[model samples]
Target chain A: MDKIKCECGHVNPEGTVLCEACGKPIEGNQHIDGNDKKTLLNMRYEGSARRSKTYTNSIVDKIWSFFSSVKVGVWLIVIALIASALGTIYPQAEYIPPEAVSRDPAVFYEATYGITGKIYYQLGLHELYGSWWYMILLALIGVSLVICSLDRYIPLRRALKIQKPKRHETFIKRQRFFSETEHVTTDEIHSVKEKLQQQRYKITEENGHILAEKGRFSRWGPYVNHIGLIIILIAALLRQTPLLFLDEYVWVREGEQTVIPGTDGEYYIENKKFIFETYSEEDGEIYKEALEKQEAMVPKNYQTNAVIYKKKGETVAGADPELEVVKEAEIRMNEPAKIGNGFTLYQAGYQLNEFHTMSFKVHRTDDQNEKALGTFTVDMNNPKHEYELDNGLTVKIDQYYPEYELDDGEPRSISKFPRNPAFVFLIYPPNETKPEVSFVGIGKNIDPTNENEYKLGIVDFDMRHVSGLTVRKDYTLPIFILGALIFMIGVIQGMYWQHRRIWIHPKGNGVLLAAHTNKNWHALKQNIEKAIANTSIKIVEDQQELDKDVSKRGGES
Target chain B: MSLEQRKANKAHKMKKRFIFRSIILILMLAAIVYALVANFNKDKSIYRAGDQAPDFKLEQINANNELESIQLSELKGKGVMLNFWATYCKPCEAEMPFMEKLYPEYKEKGIEIVAVNLDVNTLVVDRFIDKYDLTFPILPDHKEQVMDLYKVGKLPSTFFIDENGVIVDKVDGALTLENLEKQFQKILPKK
Candidate 1:
């Protein structure tokens, strides 16, 4: 191949339209035909590193050009899809057996799932999505998209911006749709321009020539879609950061307060009440029988009346710390209650079991004589509060234990029911500054010392039902939503819009017209014929047939 | 240049572009296939040692031999030893006696030892409990809910939770008598 030397001392390959070193056209490059010149002008990076001799020969340049190719981009996408599919063959590590994660995955796989499991673990299919290779594949695709779009965008923009109405006779003659007519006056040109304008074409008029183009932005559709996709990928990677997303399950039994996890215990959600309802047969005959039997009760809806509170001071266990209700709403499935910041409380599920309440009897023993102080009831759901008593004695119920048991000299609750309810109490006698601590079990005194002057004993209680809820806080949700919307728009533009252009110039007192479209040539042809109707313009032969004839004539010569 | 020469030049350029693109595509495909076969596998637990222990429910046979459901959330404000074990595991069996020995002392200080047996057979679990003479609650996790929640990977895994339901420490292997004592003390509620 011969190298064309430009005036700026740059040697470009034969058929090069633009100089590789300087942003100037190669002078007297006869190898580039009129059609090739048009295409070269439409390119974004006329003198990009991919085309420069010195740059393209380097190793980094080779790598850059490799990724800039659209074929490489498609290949990367295909690989990512296959890897994702393989990941589904075996359950991802998160969904696998809990034991499988800790031990040698190969051994666990062989012990549990047999030979296929061994192969899956051996190939890293267990955690394919999070693997370094899969991440690298995604990163490569991103690089390919960026380089591909940028390499073409600049020249394409310049070509579209600097389009002129007048072109070389051969350039106009070579278009797929061409026509001419005699006696084309200024009035005829104005009429043709008006006709093009009616079709929403952006017209640019020059002396004895006119250029009309439509859907110019359509050429940018692919780049737009690529940008949207890149944004989505970046957002997905950001979501992996711990601070950007949180998914936690919390169980706040009816009237019980629990700290929402992942919030640093700064907020608490209290379930005021849990409401569960089933579709009644009266509402629909299909559910009538099930509702009567109460056997196949299909749940209509379940909700939890929840209150979110902001912690005021340090949370002290077994004491009612000061808290202010920040937000109150009913949390239901699909209808989460937005709490402080981006935190949301969802009523995920509920449990039905026997609930329990604890009652205490206060007695003052003086000189072996026992006197009744007062009786107080402690609701297990809301027990961490002080209860004022008569006779100048104050009692604070610190904790309530259902099914209380003693293990190795320690007092604890073994079950959630009222089988053996126990209450921890701090009693302040009338004249004593120090309060007496006591553990009162159902029907018995559990305190080993039995040294308190005032005795607190659990007198009575009952059992009732509870709900479960899930809390979530995701900061990347907005970014995901915006990216999806932009992607949808880009897809519509890239797939449905077509870029079309037409040129009209005077030739020997007649008008010569030519037209081209990036897609849908048949439609472009019909549009050209419609635009030039009611005029003296004559349709020429099809551009492809004309080219074939020209080639045959050249062969004969 | 003649038309034939121009056509020939165009064909040559097209062929060069196609070859360059094809080469890159082939290389990318080869690299992807190699990665699929040679990538290393590692799985980490979702819930760490210091993270708050997720709550779950299980059914256990009471003293009267009736099935009663227990929820871990109800044990909030109390130190809890959440142990996941199986009847057939020897290490689990070996640690049962030590747990039984420490159960009473910890229970007095408001610490409960909930030994969750990941056995579907209640008869086997009952017999195992009888053999060890264990007095603590032996919850039967027939569905393995607690096991999955805790991501209990070994034969005998234990999580020690403080009064605030925060997991103070997690043990993956069977705890010896001394280790049990140390963990139990750490999980005991502050007076």
Candidate 2:
């Protein structure tokens, strides 16, 4: 490749389509055919040579060109959007039942939704957003955006920066809007310059030639938006890194603390109390109609008084970790408590009146009135093997069932929740030879042997509320917000402004006038016509309009 | 400037840009590949079949009926049956008898059954073990740490690990005696 030197004595880089200083079309360039004056100058990138257009041999050049193509970029965006839409056709695997997802998601989809769901599962559409192929699509789009902007932005910047006030007559004539005058006075040129200055155009003059440019910053709008889009895509990909994104749920009983999941055991949250209120007739007249429509009581508010704690230091396994209080706040629906390290806890749900403790009394079976001997309270969650009553009788637990149920002829529990608690008590009386065995529940009392000297009777029970908190950790939130703001700025800059340039030069005893704009050509032409008013210079005509009329007549014929 | 010299300089700049862009593209591709590979690998927090059973230490009632801490990593060379259960779970109780019956026979064949109880009260677990006469190691997860470690959503969930400590099979619900024996055979030592 040989460097081309324009007749004006300006040296240009290899593959230069037009001289950087003088704007003269370089001979032997592929973009220029023999005698280029007949066609409009391809002013995209200001006729500057771009890497993607110049190179085609090497593999790197091929890859660059592939990503630089606006066509390819548009196609990638369309395909990605379609793929994302397909993901929403059904519930994602994460939203499905936990048991189904944990055991076999394929079976669940097939069993629930039949053939389409099976196909969806088989194609891995249930987790479409997380699929490797979908991520690759997004990565390809990001790469395309970066390359497309780089392919043109560098050359455009260089062309704008290296531009001169003087340009060749042929280049000016080939512009979409062009005109000429046989005689132009220096005073008329000065008047035109003054009018352009009034219009906020930046004017540059060299040897009586004038170039006026306005809104040049708007030309960088597309590239700036592309950069913002690339940042957004990168932030989306960053979520794959561990701890950058977290969504988990934890249930903490009133007065009990629970370790927040995804915090690496570094944080814990305690619920002091769970408050639940419902709208009633006594609430207000405004909610009367809405409340009356609901068959069941409508909830008005639910909040959890939460206290966050951070682990102090390393602790041995199976031992309690020492915790230091971090903060305390009330968490309600849509109002989350912000803990440090990008974590927030929201009150998601509440279970009211869960069995917490149960009390029992030892009763003598021989007494007519079933006189109570001694009373003992049992913590349903952490029960003791034996309980000593102040009245001198002792009762020992032989068996316990938190959620008791009868299966066939055997007594067992269906679950570990203290919903329907039952217990087998061994009542030991003072100075007695043997202990009496009794089966006791909330409303049932039976002696298995049917000949016990003592029995266990239910006394009182206590219930507490459990609050469910959803913990969310998103460190990429600030980056996403920044990207969105930059994108909005780019869009506003591009849409609300236009880059306009006017070139005026003396050529062969006549003055040539040409105008160009990135968009809103009508506005630019009107501005030019008004600026060159009351001057000897002729108003510029839109050559594109004349060409379109000629083409239309040719079509009609 | 000489035309030849200017051409050479232009070529050098192009090559430099190409190298710089190539490195960036390669690095981006590498990051994407790393993310995909990390996703393909099972998260250690979640346990499933074919995953390396996460090592944990828990307290169990031994032959002396006393609380003794045992580690899963300590039984690496033995085929282990790790069962997450609670004394209140009926399905877990239904499978206990089969586990107890197979415990003696399998213990002689380099197999060990370890039950992790997700009960808040150790008394219930002890009473259940006594009533069932279960001889296998019964660990009490009083704080439910081991339960959370395995992410057990339901009771009677069992992980069958081979001698190499890799989980060979996992059942989320109750298994019959025959099914339990079959699963045990899968993790039994070859010899």
Candidate 3:
């Protein structure tokens, strides 16, 4: 094989290790660890562990090194940064369709990163706070943080526990500050020690050599704080689970009791009052807009007949309402009545409702048809008695709308609580195929709307208010809270007081002092320099007079 | 070694540690920006409020008397009103006659109205159309592709496309002829 001259341009031989002419290393066989004759495509795969081969270190050892290595920590920080950037691409806790949530290859990339809005939807990227993936990422980060912290924690504890006074002479001499003096005795140093003690420094004297370690043991606090953060993150994630569901919305609606999807009892909320209290942001004004601005008073709570029924085994359907399970009672919105191990209700919101004049059919339109299509105004709160109707139709109030409005040609109500009452009727008979629904406005002409010859009119109208209540059952809250509290404590302890070590040695006539800290070294240095000002030393002088000196140096130029 | 010198050197190193903590805090804030929205791709679906619509053919309910199929491409010189409505939706009933007045006035400006009915029975639709005295295209969307393709979740939707079949704007609820004329002005070129 022919060999060309390399710049520093010196050539020796084909398999030469070094260039004999210029005494420079040859660019020949030494760097040719593999064949140069073979192309990259034809190169045989080593199939060896590349990381291990490159590192020549155990992965565990590497992980340990990485945990302590600022470089690896920086890389982890970079990963966190990149991950955060990815987070900005979409929100977390987005509306994820269940089918796309699985790790299907065709959808995984799209679902995970949300290339085609899937990232926005299925991945819950929009609602990042409560998303499964974000929580998982947080969990992974927490685990790594825990593992990394634990890995450093043990060694740091052990290392910080004991002090080796026998440091290298060169290291002690190489310290940034030192002083040379002869006449001072060890007795004169007692005053300095007293002063340091006054500053709340912990002084530990080991062997004949005096080793005073202050703020020494506190260095391990940051590690403890890390463990706390992991716990806190876990607690945060736990709070978002289905077991700890937090459904926050205004009122569910009055008289229309929901079964409390995640809880035990079916809370029957009654809208007793929907009072909107407002205050003025500007100088105590008493206007409606000002009041709304000052205090965003929403429907506070639900006051209703809360009947708790046992899990089916306790009573028959026909059994008396008194025999039903009396688990607990609650008014909702901060007024909870506890009866057993199970519930708690909070008033998240209320529906602003009004009374309605129901129009239901009392009699059948046809004699053959058994259907009694009628317009009756029966109170929604009490459907049992006191029915009223305008004409032949016996009306029963079914659903009431308070704040009613008309959209398109149909009547629609904004408020379900009957703030402005309207009736939805079941008209039976003569025209049973399609029941007539006419919104007879309060005191409006209904004669024109009775186009159907078999007129069904409102007989009775009752307006009773109702409220919607929310009930909750979450057993894991206390545990999750406990985790958070513990985490906070750990974090405070670990993050504040860092472990700082200083080595002091007598070098001939000069004393050599070298220091190292687990965290906040710059502050530690500044503090050391400040403390050094008290001591009569030139080399270890404080930073107080440097600004003037720098000004002087600049002024000369 | 001098007794005074050893104490002073240890003090200086402690000051440097505090500076390291501040840098870490700044990076933490910068990393947090990734969780917010950053992408800026404009949505250009023809069903959306602002996009060029494609030509389509639909049967016109010329009045209660006759039915004639109208192609949007054939009426390329004039603006087109595409209304997606259903019989069950009450809002569609209120919007019908207003469109009739609009068809005659704007038909001179090359404006044509195509009402896509999402219903089953022709007799029911025909009766409603006859009752309302509407003079516009009343085509059936029985195949359901247009509704599915347009992703119309709500009924009584209307899309105003230009003479070139480019969709200029759309509305979810019912519209009166006066408001529709204003919408036409927004999409149409100024003379």
Candidate 4:
């Protein structure tokens, strides 16, 4: 390496702008970029020789400089922020119905939200966070964070570690705060050192030169913050792994058990009961006005008494497996039940008034008394084909429709659930060889032959409520929490403290006193003034003000 | 230290840090890119036409009200028409007669229609079969597991699988008699 030999018998690297051992500016170094000799020195990075500032020849150098530039990092952040805002103009793909997206997203977007939505969908903004360009933007920011921190941190640490408390007239003169004291005694210097020590500054002395330093660890704040940000970004990316994250939903009816989705059949949840309530005027006086004005009942609560079970044996397809009870809890809105294996079940929705069981009575058509010959109850979930009653009367279900409807003059069921049950019954009376056929439904009964002797009448029925639960498992939550904690610590450490240093150099029967701080120059000046109180040393003045005055005078000349 | 030695030491340290950071960066990017590519390549959540139909086993109420299970893998060699429906879906009722009509004729040609009933009540499904006089197999998805597995957003969703177990076509709504017959002919197994 080519070296620059300074007048103080110290050598510096070829690209070094200032001597490292002694703070003397090396003039006429074309590779180094800084303020002119007239103004205060740009001590942002301690006048250190950074690689980004010195090298721009190779491709690697260019890439390194590109990422290490704070300007580039800020621009990347701004672009990412704007893109994230644009994503919120419409719901993301996850918020959209999965079936609609799977069937055809383009059609759904256009039909639902018009032309702008069509354009958004076409640009792949529907899945903005997951889009390739967005991911690339995030990756670029991560690269910038890594490169920028490394570029500045290493050189600054080196500069501070090798710093000396010695004579450098120009360095002292260019400091933001500088002062000269005439005929200062050794006792005064000793008193100043004692005052600084009382203020918790570490004092170092060399050849009657003293340097008081405090809060040097605050210089590492930005680097620590960058590290935390990188960890958070990595945690966000890990969510894409299926093993670390899962979200699914299941519907469990009252008195029924369902294998929780996304558990690979290891967990089962049963809904013991579901309770849903709506606010009425009688409940409270506060909601009476709102309820009356809205003319709608507002839901107050949704709770599900649920039991979680763990599969104890091997799962066989199409067969019920043995289960062991794990825990039972009442899952309510915003109060999810935590099952084992990082799974949590949340009450999502409920279906009320679902048919449970229905009963019917067989009656004589000609009797005015409406006396029933036989009565039978049908379980909506599982009905019998035959029902025997007293006096040798029998009623047989020839056909059944759980949710009955008329299609082309024929009776049919729209669904398997007993929403509107209907049945064809063949009734047999004692001492009769021929059977009478009767069609029965919720509110309708018809005899096609019109010669039936027996009729079926509606009796009573039972209803149930079905509860919907969402199962979620997120393993990256702890990583995010850890990253946020580190970030907070870094922010507080960096913002709430300043790294201050004051250098005292003996100069011709007096001392040239100069001080510098990374931030809050006013506070550093006040500290120095207080420490030298009652001594012969005068108050320090900001030399930047003197520089301005000189420039104004030179302009007039 | 001499300026020459200090510069050499810094350069060596810089090279080491660069290599270490580069390795970490490359590994992270590789994992992210791999995940993105893999997610784009195969979305197994919703099946489409030309994909292999996912196999499942479900129990159904037989004529004698016995619990019997049927596995889709056992019917791999036969042409399968898998229909997902609920008892309350009206469109499903409109299409059942067409399915029943084609089942007898297509059974001789190695095409079988399997209706999956997404109902909580077994009696409702049994009564539905009796009403339509459906001769085809009826499998009740009691927990609606098969319904979710097929990603059937709408009722009367059907998949026509050829003899090789690959889905030839997928229909999301009620099919007309002609459309149903055409779908049956498409999945007819070769003699």
Q: What's the ranking of the predictions by TM-score, best on top?
A: 4, 2, 1, 3
| Tens digit of per-residue lDDT, candidate 1, span A1-557 | 45566565654555455555433555554234233434223223332233322235445557756776777889999999988898887677556443332333545566578898889898888878878878788878877877677556644565456456665555566556777677776776777788889988888876767788898777787777777876776676656554566677776666667666656556777778888887875687876766777767778888888888887986332233478999889887899888876788877878665445666778864534445678777665345457878778888655555557776775555443444556677888877678888877756665546687778665565654466777788887888888788888877786677788888878889887887666777877777777777777775445665453344221000
Which rank order by lDDT, best down to worst? 2, 4, 1, 3
Global local distance difference test of model 4: 0.79
lDDT of each: 0.67, 0.80, 0.47, 0.79
Give the CA lDDT, 0 to 100, for residue A141 in model 2.
83
TM-score of 2: 0.72
lDDT of 4 by residue, A481-537 (tens): 888888878877788888999999999989999998888888898889878988899
- Look at candidate 2 and give me any clashing residue pairs: none
What is model 2's DockQ versus the real complex? 0.35
Binned by DockQ into CAPRI classes (incorrect, acceptable, medium, high), candidate 3 is incorrect
DockQ-best of 2 and 4 = 2
RMSD of each: 14.9, 7.3, 19.5, 7.4
Regions more than 4 Å wrong, model 1:
A1-60, A98-106, A180-187, A251-259, A264-267, A278-300, A309-326, A348-468, A495-497, A509-511, A520-523, A539-557, B1-131, B135-191
- Which is the better candidate, 2 or 3, if ranked by lDDT? 2
Please tell me how candidate 1 rates in CAPRI terms: incorrect
Backbone clash count for every predicted candidate, in the order shown: 19, 0, 97, 7
Evaluate chain B of model 2: give its TM-score.
0.75
**Residue A362's C-alpha lDDT in candidate 2?**
75
Q: Pick by DockQ: which candidate is best?
A: 2
Q: After superposition, how far is residue A273 of candidate 4 from its true place, in Å?
A: 4.0
